[model samples]
Target: AAGTLIVGGGQAGFQVAASLREAGYADPVVLIGDEPGLPYQRPPLSKAYLAGKTDAEGLNLRPASYLAEHRIAHRPGTRAARIDRDARRLILADGESLPYDHLVLATGARNRDLPVPGADLAGVRQLRGLADADRLREAIGAAERVVVVGAGFIGLEFAAVAAAHGLAVTVIEAAARPMARAVSAETGAFFRAAHEGWGVRFAFSAGVTAIEGTDGRATGVRLAEGDVLPADLILVGIGVVPNAELAAEAGLAVADGVRVDAFLATEDPAISALGDCARFPSAFATGLGRDDTVRIESVQNAIDQGRCLAARLAGRPAPYGAVPWFWSDQGRHKLQIAGLAGPDDASVLRGSGDAFSVFRFRGGILRAVESVNRAADHMVARRLLAAGTPLTPEQAADPGLDLKALAT
Candidate 1:
């Protein structure tokens, strides 16, 4: 008998299963994953994994012995076909069903498809899961020139890795700046320069029209502006679409993702959602004058949400109010951001030189801090934001005042 049924074996699902055992709610926690391997972290897929600095063994979040020792049933290469909400059971792909007292949906998200004319070419790839990363890694090594569509974090990160390996890398983006949706323009410009300094070319404000291929192999990418960029390999990194079809089919309220309450519970009390697949009421303001739904795609968000949902299932219901944080690794720059800043916010620079911090202010209140190659400042920003301590722009800009001390 399965005590808890977790759908999707990514980071969020694995964390919840581990947390349930840690919280002493052990009966039989079973994790069903569609992928054919152990649960692994996705962040390293674009960075160290592609750089060959770490192998598959290093990517596993937990060893097989740990799961076995905890008596957690790990089911890989298994897909959850559907959910019978009334019966509280999950129908598997192999014509089997598992009943659960509590269910956790960590279905995560999949890479959005590039609907261009030549998207189906053999050399075109999208990096999202572990398998995708493995294929891209192989392609990157054999290809001389790589054209990346969309200048988001994943695209830029992969470009940096390819450029570091002396491969000709060109990043095409529809927007004027990279990561315009997530970071401030200052931070975006900083990364653009950093990647450019490392020999990565940028095609800003360029939209890809199609991927030109010969004999089923991608030859180059055709832009909307009628320019053909020659490439032996192409990677699509537009964004990701949440895997919320399961929740929607089960009649749960679905907007951008599986809709959840403050406690990470869906409309159905017995079911919960977390990680990228979940869009819950955010604790931070989205500049829309009210709390809106947010679907964060970061390791920190997944881990924190997993822990919070597990605590709720353990009968210690707590509102998920974690300070949203994110990080991106491009070349030698370790860009870290604490708190979410809106487009209307004002940015202030604190330090000068290779290492500096950018403080985001909205209506005289400190909203976020973006640190570049400054680990210490990033740590302090996380602590200060978590404590809800107020820091004005003047105080934050003071060069002599230590951020860690002020945060305390």
Candidate 2:
């Protein structure tokens, strides 16, 4: 009650509690999570975990014994109902209240539901938690024809796994291309070709109107264009809606997400938010007629923000300014993105063949770099962007120029 009370036991929450202890903070750290198990990795749930390549134990951020040894109280399967900011307390759904010297809102985002008829069918599934992954894995085994409603990272990843299993996989996307909002056109086209080579089908600029079902189980997905795609299972990976209702109810600044300053601190000094739920100012933000604050949903952002907030809580205050980076493993190729790119950003190509990097520039300034199977370029891009080193489009286009040397 006298220490930190962390709500939402995701990666960010786990990191904050772990970092607080690592920083030698002798405060009583109690983490409250609605989930029924210890905090585990979420990214793998759509990839290796669903493929049965990794067990649930392998996904654990740490064993229960580690938490006990660290003296961090972890309350699993408990939901936080309200934030009593006036009393500096977090009210739980069970009518229990937790008082805290410092409050952390790490309530991560939830999977966006498919708003269509028959979406609640038994064969329709979403991958978010361990339980969801467990069900998906079992479903994939029995499913012959799989239809993914979105071509986002999670959907693509699941499609790759299904394709590998020799299942008929079709990815339907409302956008013109896969990952339209995230990656550049060149990168998206490359991945499109790659996924196609793996026997995966894609329906671009298509929307699901309804899921056709029989016997309370999904039979296929009907598109807006009056076409029905047959499927034994439907996987919806549209996106996520941030869990900012609690913060909003508590009278905290909330827009697309819980608004926080660069330090990840809300208007109230005692309250802070991070992970996928908090939108804070980013130096890497494109800010080209868009919100300067970004709510990134990657492991990098979660861990970095957690450490940043943890340091501030431990008396070493520094603004959260880590270079944003993200990755997705689809089939044999790996896509790694460094920095943040604007939609209208100009792209420059470097390297060739199946492996290359797309350097995106906004207003003649390097904003982001997307690397495909080129880990070297990704590392250099992050270093260059983080140090604010000026990388000209000409230098990026030049094959002879050594980015590693320049970064060094």
Q: Against the true structure, what is each candidate's TM-score?
A: 0.97, 0.98
Q: Per-residue alpha-carbon lDDT of model 2 for 252-347, expressed as tens digits?
A: 999878999988999999999999999999878856536688899999999999999999999999999999999999999999999998767999
State residue 217's C-alpha deviation in candidate 2, in Å: 1.2
Clash-forming residue pairs, model 2: none
lDDT per residue, candidate 1, 32-134, as tens digits? 9999888999999999998989999899999999999987899999999889988989999898999998889999999999988989989999998888889
Lowest summed-lDDT stretch of 10 residues in model 1? Answer: 283-292
Which number leads on TM-score?
2
True-structure RMSD, every candidate = 1.4, 1.0
Off by over 4 Å in 1: 286-291
Off by over 4 Å in 2: none
| CA lDDT of each prediction against the hidden true structure | 0.89, 0.93
Candidate 2 displacement at residue 265 in angstroms = 0.7
The whole-model C-alpha lDDT of candidate 2 against the native structure comes to 0.93
